[model samples]
Structure formats: structure tokens, C-alpha cells
Target: MLQEVAGIRIPDTQLAKDAADILREHGDNLLWNHSNRVFLFGAVNVRKTKQHYDLELLYVSALFHDLGLTKKFNSPDLRFEVDGANAARSFLQQYQIPDESIRLVWDAIALHTTPGVAEHKEPEVALLFSGVGLDVMGDGFEQFPADYREEIIKAFPRNNFKRDIIPAFYEGFKHKPETTFGNMKEDIVKHFRPNYKNKNFCDCILHSPWTE
Candidate 1:
């Protein structure tokens, strides 16, 4: 079934792809598919970014990042940073992926939840963003409940949070404190949203602000 679905000729040794097949619970939650597509596009840009590596490394990293999702869900105690990287390492060792490639895979897994780690860098940062960051926010990140959906305005590095996590959770929501929530409210209501009468700079969304 997986061979028919994936339409590729891979051996039994490559459990990552098989893992992907096992993990596709919903059509929309096909994180692995999204990840694969992101890697396909991201790698094109990675090739142009002047980072030294073979194609193999990118493939290994891209495939490895999502390994812990099901494992985490089945036994919810697993932290993404701990369980995800360990799962990736186990697979990489089985595939005989080199040490350097394994490191990239580990880094990719570690920081997929926290983009700020790769924020300023190219390829590495964008690869992680394209792979999971964008999906974690959905098209607008507005589908989440009001308490958990908020803007990302934190300054980089130390103060920055995992901007995409809260906005896309199906359940197990986390709410930011007042200062954080108020800042997000300002960003959405003041900066992103506008008064209905102010037509000059406002987007079409607020054109008839109260009438929607």
C-alpha cells in the first residue's frame, strides 16, 4: 500500500518513508507530505545558498524531522526536542547517514518547533520554516481560539517564543500572559486591523469593519 501510495521504489531499510505512511492520520495532517514538498522546494534554494553539502543530507534531515510526532502522541510525555532528535538519530544510524548529515537532521528536528534559532540564517532557517512553521500557523493562524491565537512580535533570540505553536493547536491550548496578550491585541487591532472610517491605508478586510 505504501509503495502504491508513495509511488517510489525504496527498500525496507528506509523506515522513515514507511513511518510517514503510518503517520498520515488525516489528509490535512499529512505533515510528512507537507514536509516532503517543503524540502523539495527548500532544497532548490538551499542549493543556491552556498552551504556545502550533498543532496543526501537535505533528504535525511527533511525526512527525519517529523519522526517523533506519532511517537509523542502515542505516549504524550515525549518532548519534541528529546524524542524527535533521538528518533532521527536512530533512523540515520540505520541508513548509514554520515555524521555531518545526522547533525543537520538533529538540528532541524530540534529547532522545527522554535524558528528563532535559525531566524537570521538562510536555507537552514527557511528550510525549517517552510517545512513546518508555515503549516503550524495555517493560512492565517486565525482559526485558533481567541485566547491562544496571537501575533508574534517578540524581539529575536532570548525573548522570542515559538511563534507558531499556540496558533495551530487542535487542543491542549496555551495562553500567553496579559502583557503578551495585550501586545498581540495591539498588533492585531491597532496595526493589523484599523478603524472602519479610516479608508486611506486600510486593507479590504476593514473596509466595512463593523458590517461584516
Candidate 2:
């Protein structure tokens, strides 16, 4: 938890406090949170060390990067970086945050997702992206054959990102258990009944683990 000093100016004190509470509630000494906590400190510490001019705006932006995930929006896809950016913009406007800081907050929030792009522009954005990914990607990660990626993309909503979102990352870490037969729900199971060859299922059971 980085505190605002005499020179630090955090407009919404409650946003700062709520962010702290979210971290404590969800954190469990995980390296992701620990490093994030350090990143927060380092970003702010830059002011003291090098007299960085954007420390306050940077810190405030970092603090609310994930604010969209709050209870305000429950849809799975709505918790993403772009959604979070929109939420930040609205929150700042509601709180009457200065126009000068609005751009800083929006930039950080938008860049938080596309780490590849932020690599050169906003290095700190990449840091925060990793911080959030290290945790979010763990919960819903998954993987499938190359051919299945497009199928997954078609199966989910545009923003849902079945093939690239947090779900895909976590799923990639582990194979599905053998007990669950069929391609997901009952639809795919019945769709391929005409073939009756069962090549897909056989290949899945044979090539996939847990076949013993």
C-alpha cells in the first residue's frame, strides 16, 4: 500500500482505500501481489530518487487499473482492460478529477492489456499487466489443439476471448480430465453422432493424458 505524501495528490481517497482492501482480500503472499506491491512503491519512489514529475498521476492510474472488476460489472468479459479503462474514465468524471489526470489514467488503463504494445511506450504498463495476468490467468487458464483455437474463438463472444483471455492461459497449464466426455456441453456430443467412427473421442483419449 503506497501512501500519498505531502507532494502526492490522490483525488479519490476512497478509490485508494478500496484498492488496498481488494489487494488484501485477494492476496495470499503470492509473488504477483508482492511484486505489484513493490512496483507500486518503485513507481512512487522514482519521485524521491529522480524527482520524476508524473509519479502521482502514474500511481493513481495504476491503482485503478482493475477497478472495473469491482461489483459494478459482473459479466465475465466486462472485467477486461478496455472495460476497466471506461470504468476509470467514468469514475474520474464522477469524482470531478482534474482533466489533466484523466488522460494519464485512461492511457495506463488502456495499455494495461496490450503488453506487447506497451513494451516501448509505457514500460510501467507492462509491469502492471504482468501483475494482473499472473493472478487472473491462473484461475481460468486452458488449452486446446491448434485447430480448436478458431473454434473457441467462434464459440465465445467477441470480448469473451475464449482462446486468449485469462481462461485460455490457465487452461493451457493443464489437460482436461477424462471423465468429461463430448466437446464441452451436449451439443457437440450429439452433432457428431452421425459419423459414429468416434475418431475425435478416440484420438482425444489416446493422445490426451489420463487414458490409463
Backbone collision tally, model 1 = 0
lDDT of 2 by residue, 42-152 (tens): 343344335434544455456556444434421244323455567657766766778766766677666665545653454445445543443334311232123332332
Model 1 over residues 1-212: C-alpha lDDT tens digits?
23211121222334555545444542223444555544444443443456654444455455555555443332244443434567767766876667866676677665665535654544554465454544434422343222222211111111212342233222211121121121222232233224412223355557756886
In TM-score terms, candidate 2 sits at 0.42
TM-scores, each model vs. reference: 0.47, 0.42
Model 2's number of clashes is: 10
Per-candidate alpha-carbon RMSD to the true structure:
15.6, 16.3
TM-score of the candidate numbered 1? Answer: 0.47
